[model samples]
Target: MIRTLDGKEEGFPSPLIQIRRQQSHLENWLENHKFPRIPCQSFVVISSPSTIIKAPKSLKSQILHSANIPYKLGVLEKKFKEQLLTKPTLKKLSKTLMEKHTEEDVDLFAKYNISKNDILTGVQCPGCGQFPAKRTQGFWRCSFCKHKAKDAHLRTLEEYKYLFGNKISNQQLRSFLHISSRTSATKFFSTLNYVHEGRTKDRVYFIP
Candidate 1:
């Protein structure tokens, strides 16, 4: 019989199976997408430790800084151990953690809902829609209005890299894109390849 971390039959085929299903879904979503923010948001909501642990080293640090959460490899390991109980059960523990994180993400999003129409005139590019177009090997262009603008979404990714590298959090990107929503930022970033890291948020820009 399948048992929960508490060692009780929770009545599902198997908690491990459930965790595997959830993880597979998450992995597929991330693989199909380019920008990290959306997946990061989902990861946060799910409280997936893998999201935190497997994140690019650059992004992880940024996430910690953006969330104002303390970071120590040992701390994460301890938390994972306490929640997971055993190495063999790490998958289930990670799923549980992701679920909790997802809850927190929903709460945070509700708290800070910004309308994109207010910032970009509600007019998206026709060719690329909200996402910019690839202009060159490291440059992106906005099809709408035919503006030769760099990727605006990459700015947040760079910020995460600068602050936490792979540890960057969705919260940080949301806050950075004050004029837009988290979803918008994620879509926008997916179009760009690089960004200019800066000290001030306003100065950040997607560099193709």
Candidate 2:
């Protein structure tokens, strides 16, 4: 589950539903693989510090345990200890899994048919997770939450590297970051330890 800093769930699959789905998937995978039908437990842990999930009583009772942040961490530790495998068993399982494991590269963006044009572009507010924070006097200020962050553009650039690719041009950065000033975009690029190819207008920056 993903939430904004303001504590709102951004996407689908509520905690209870997600946990049920996980349980179902686990059972299916084990059966398909011809593995022993070992007992399994599923948990929906909301790690966002600001987010407090208030599930229905009926749903809560059905779930194994739904905890938040640090509390969830403790539960995880306890669960792991309870299901702890011996060193020999661990080694055997690892060896068995490794023999059947095969690495596959997946392009999720393409597979999901997500368009670059549909993606929101701007400096996002770190405090409230709002976008299009105005660049003001060496700091990015959010009009919504009144949060100001210095070097906020750095986070936006890092996101760009993930959503797009490692290589980006000055114009592309400006468009994606909603930056109008070429000098400002260049200044932002200079702070990063990146490699560049081509000269002047044709130059492209690569995150090394």
Candidate 3:
């Protein structure tokens, strides 16, 4: 399912050619894997119910709103129930697909013309929803709420790694996590068993 913020619609998501090309790519991949060819269906959902969607009749995808999903899903269940793969084959296929999968790195900050340095440091305090909570000695304390946490830095690191990059430097972690003291930052680094490479400032840490 797909949705657009503006109640605007083009022929097949973007243009006429891309849908067929993408479907062909999927079919080729399935053929290479010796799997059954599946039908490609498309759906575009829009928030504004008042706005009409002028979809092309040639396309296989449907354009609908959230209100129509339940009925559409009911109809789709029949197709899903028609095919049944053996338990072992299904498990093996799923495992193999997972093992061979590659992740695409996306840099949202750069795409949106935002600077990483401008981002607020430290974990957002859950109690007060305030940013860059002070990294006091042995605690992450929110100045406004007077709330303190020990493991708040962990959540901040997870966001940093997700939105920025999979790997982080000691300096990056310290700056982003709002740790002023190098000794404390090093101490925090010691707590994690992340895989490391390079020497001194050249070093990077990533989940093994």
Candidate 4:
């Protein structure tokens, strides 16, 4: 006899034990009813809906019926034969399916207004100022007028700011500009004729 938490004698066979036994029996029945064979990689052509399949000689009608795979051996063979006959049609169908899938992908991208360039580059060159300088065989040219400067200028200015703490000396400016000679550097500096509120050596040039 089993006793419940409420202090009552349940029965010789408790409700919990009976339920477990029933569950086990049901599981065994289901396992026995399941099909023994796995499905093959064969695909049926949709062109002929009345096609059939033929099972192997080893699998009898009684066994097939027990497995619940509803098909006679003759019907299975007929279906396979029909599939072979419709090979050309299947190829055309496959090609059309691929084309339709590709078209759908393209349409989805277009709907989102996403650009290929955006995918490649994090930011698109806005073509602002002289950015994305026109490319020549050996150098990049300005997209604007014929105003051309050596590629070195862009890098030099940045270096000048770093070296001189932004209060660039005349000599330092020349070095930044990459002038070949000190004389040429001085000449360029004189052209600016910048005058600051200090002595000559301490004077800073300001762009006019």
Candidate that would win on lDDT:
2
**TM-score (all chains, Cα) for each model:** 0.20, 0.52, 0.67, 0.22
What TM-score should be assigned to candidate 2? 0.52
Query: Candidate 3 residues 1-208, lDDT tens each?
Result: 2345689633334634565576678778767998766666556555667856666675434667778888878888876776656778778778878987898777878778988776777789978889868877778899889899988877778888778777888888777877777777777778887888888668888843
Off by over 4 Å in 3: 1-21, 45-61, 65-71, 107-110, 197-204
Question: Which pairs of residues clash in candidate 4, taking residues 3 or more apart in a chain or in different chains?
Answer: 52-75, 52-76, 53-75, 53-76, 53-77, 54-73, 54-76, 54-77
Q: Regarding lDDT, does 2 or 3 come out ahead? A: 2
lDDT, residue 191, model 1: 54
- Give one digit per residue, the lDDT tens place, for model 2 in 82-194: 55456776676668668877956556589889877778899989999998998878788999999999888887888887778779999998898787789988987887768
Candidate maximizing TM-score: 3
Using lDDT, rank the candidates from best to worst: 2, 3, 4, 1
**Candidate 1: tens digits of C-alpha lDDT, residues 139-177:** 345655555544444454543344334433334444543
lDDT of 4 by residue, 17-95 (tens): 4555766665554346442222232222223333233435543332222223345445666655633325675566457
Where's the lowest-lDDT run of ten residues in candidate 3?
Answer: 8-17
Query: Candidate 4, which segments miss by more than 4 Å at Cα?
Result: 1-155, 190-197, 206-208
Give me the runs in candidate 1 sitting further than 4 Å from their true place. Answer: 1-84, 103-117, 122-208
Please give the distance, in angstroms, between residue 6's alpha carbon in candidate 3 and its true position after superposition: 11
- The 10-residue segment with the lowest total lDDT in model 4: 119-128
Model 2 misplacement above 4 A: 1-105
**Worst ten in a row by lDDT for model 2:** 61-70
